[model samples]
Target: MKIKVNSEACIGCGACEQIAKDLFEIGDEGVSKAKVSEVPEDKKAMAQEAIDGCPTGAIQGEE
Candidate 1:
């Protein structure tokens, strides 16, 4: 799976980072960014939760 954060749409609320720190982080510009391009199977569930938790729908995953 691939994980991506839409920097233009992200509000940087930190939900993604908080829910899945292994996959995301808040940048110096205050937007959420994907720490990695691909999501490991072991981390997909947590990544989904992070995607769901994002208020702005900035986090996305593709399988």
Candidate 2:
């Protein structure tokens, strides 16, 4: 699966990064960004957590 962050919806709250640092990061633009092109098998759960934890629902998972 792949993760995406909606720049327009993100608030730079850092919840996603805090929940899954390996999957997300606060980019130079001040919004959260996906760190990898795809989510690793072991990181899927964490990625989902980050998505769920996002205050603005900015994170999305794609097949």
Candidate 3:
């Protein structure tokens, strides 16, 4: 599974980070962005939660 972030849709909220800090992070500009971390298949559920929990709907899955 690959995580994709729509930077344009992100509103700098830390919701995703709160849900999955290992998979996401606040960028230098303070926007919520995908962290350069590996996500195991078992963590897909948590990742999905983070994606769905994003208030700005900025996160998605590639497959």
Ordered list by TM-score, greatest first: 1, 2, 3
lDDT of 1 by residue, 7-60 (tens): 989998998999999999999999988999989899999999999999988887
Using all chains and alpha carbons, the TM-scores for the candidates as numbered come to 0.95, 0.95, 0.87
Which parts of model 1 are misplaced by more than 4 Å?
A: none
Error of 3 at 21 (Å): 0.5
Alpha-carbon local distance difference test for all models: 0.92, 0.92, 0.83
lDDT tens digits by residue: candidate 2, 3-58 = 89999999999998988999999999999999997999999999989988998999
Candidate 2: Cα lDDT at 37: 71
What is candidate 1's CA lDDT for residue 62? 95
Residue 56's lDDT in candidate 2: 90
